[model samples]
Target: MTLFSPLHLREVTLPNRIGISPMCMYASQDGQVSDFHVAHLGRFALGGAGLVIAEATAVHPHGRISPFDTGLWSDEQVPGWRRVTALVAASGSVPGVQLGHAGRRAAVREPWRAGAPLDETDAAAGFAPWPLVAPSALPAGPGHAMPAELTARQIAHSVQDWHDAAVRAVSAGFRFIELHGAHGYLLHSFLSPVSNRRTDRYGGSAENRLRYPLEVVAAVRDAIGDGIPLSFRVSAVDGAEGGSGIEETVHIARRLAAAGVDLIDTSSGGITTDRSTDTRIRRGFAFHADFSRRIRDEAGVPTATVGLVVDAEQAERLLDHGDADMVLLGRQVLDDPNWPHHARIALGDDSHDSWDVRYGSALGPRARTLARLTASGETPLTRFSP
Candidate 1:
């Protein structure tokens, strides 16, 4: 896809397909954002991303995977997030936040701490990992606590939490909202049979498993109104034997569209104990051709293809072939914050004048000088941001 083409979702127009994926920052203090987050997301906006989804923020404190996770459950978080949204928007990129609940994955150590399970002492200090909740009483891995099955009341409260979070996101100046329903988190736990084994209405059959996720989407949409674009990131397949499969994910996408989802962000795995079984299939290459195409053609909703999607040409081909509406770069963008600028050149949008106007001033050169350098392939380069 041409990085600069407008992507219309409701009233919002993304300036490009190049979006910064929601990578967990784990920099929040007591679920409150700090200057670190503002600088992190704001730089992407300034770097020329058309859209910037803030890291996966929890809907409630207990829903956090670690004590450092951002939260929207309190009004106090809004002001800090607003500071970030304003900075991102000032640079012309749309601001967004991905709301999620970690469920059985909750209360773990930060990624820098190796993301390990904590003990009772750690839990008492507010870092202690404990039994998580899910559709069933299953644990994510060895040494992880087997979660408790959620009651109907708990499920209802969870939906309300998402609804409230959406409202807060909008108030914080976010134009888009994405529910983090993938990666073996709370919503994905319900969607995948590998973790969700309940016989209640929220489990067992595929329809039942999909119910909670769909409800959260509906609730968020209702909370945010039709003017804002709402999206859901889903593990299109569990990548596990007899786990949530393509067909089930497709069905879930269809229902999500009907329930007011603007796009299906297709991701996989994170719901199983075994990721090695399919690691060789070219990471992030699983659903682009088959599942994403099926969902877009059959369900008639735009889809965002994620996972290992980095190369500019590969993303363009996926869009040209009508497989997905948008390509979300995770690690690639992480590795190169200026990926969009490079992609613009690759897609033949190489108006050196435009790119320079956006970035070259930071290089201490006049537009004409930068253009001359770019045309001559003699622009001096230094170490790029990762």
Candidate 2:
């Protein structure tokens, strides 16, 4: 398999394996996506991402990591997403959305402002800190507020919350839905031993810890139905002591597949907000390949690997070597929305056949001109060589 190869997940056939990783823009208002999100996401689709998954959208308003995070909790938010999905589909890319709950990690500032928990100083600025909920009553970090332990009744309600969000996602025109069970999020918190300190059926053993997230999976699947594809993103390692490991994640992947999840969006390290104890895999090219490879092979499920996958050859090699079924690009794609189209050129599609005609019609000729100039020894610095 190559980077440009098509991937069939259920009834959805991605024209290529490259996908835009769901990176939160934190630019929404009242959980509604704005014009900024439209241009931001649509550009990637127009640039040639086979699948464009929108950022981690909260299922509940309080589930938001920040006041600005997108939400699927209400119908009001669905119309905004519809505009985005329509644009992505027009550009021939499948639109997807990642459903998530921040858990105890909620009520924080954006990453630009140090991502600290909101305080009175911020509350005065119109962003009030909200209560947090988790598997146990614990704070995410030093300055974070302590979260209330979710009762059995609340957990059941939360499960339905996910179901309702998934239903909203479908209505919003997303063909694919991914559960963000990574990065210290509510779902990940429950899965990790470090975060889940509860004594009930939802906590103690590994099986118990997986309970809440699995219920969510079932709920989402029931909401979206058999025709739509469901993907689960997992923090393959908790990146903290006394937490689940790769082997445990592989087992989780197996269970997820059994629960009707079509793919595992393999990621890592969000189980703790404590950087002091962080042991996440280093961010290198295709860093999550090992985790994804193990899950795909051991659990016999399709997996997508992300993290620092910047180059065309690097992404292609991951697929060629069976590291993952697909590769998701985040920062790299953000840097150049047309990375997929550029990658096509790098991988021998020199005529810009894959790029949208709007771009290809111009870039096609530019390539020939540049090549001709190079053959004639006309480098940018050549004019000064004399």
Q: Tell me the tens digit of each residue's lDDT in model 1 across 43-103.
A: 8887778889998899988789888899899888999999999998888889989999998
Candidate 2 vs. true structure, TM-score: 0.97
TM-score of each: 0.90, 0.97
Stretches of candidate 2 exceeding 4 Å from the true structure: 379-386
Predicted model with the maximum TM-score: 2
Candidate 1 regions exceeding 4 Å error are 120-126, 274-281, 284-289, 352-386
TM-score of 1: 0.90
- What's the lDDT for all of these models? 0.82, 0.93
Query: Candidate 2, residue 255: CA error in Å?
Result: 0.4
Model 2 lowest lDDT segment of ten = 277-286
Q: lDDT, candidate 2, residue 138?
A: 78
Put down candidate 2 lDDT per residue, 1-386, tens digits, no spaces: 38888999888899999999999998988999999999999999999999999999999999999999999999999999999999999999999999999999999999999999999998999999998999998788777899999999999999999999999999999999999999999999999989999999999998999899899999999998888989999999989878899999999999989998999999999777777887877887778999999999999999999999999999999998889999999999889999998898889888787777888899889999999999998998987896
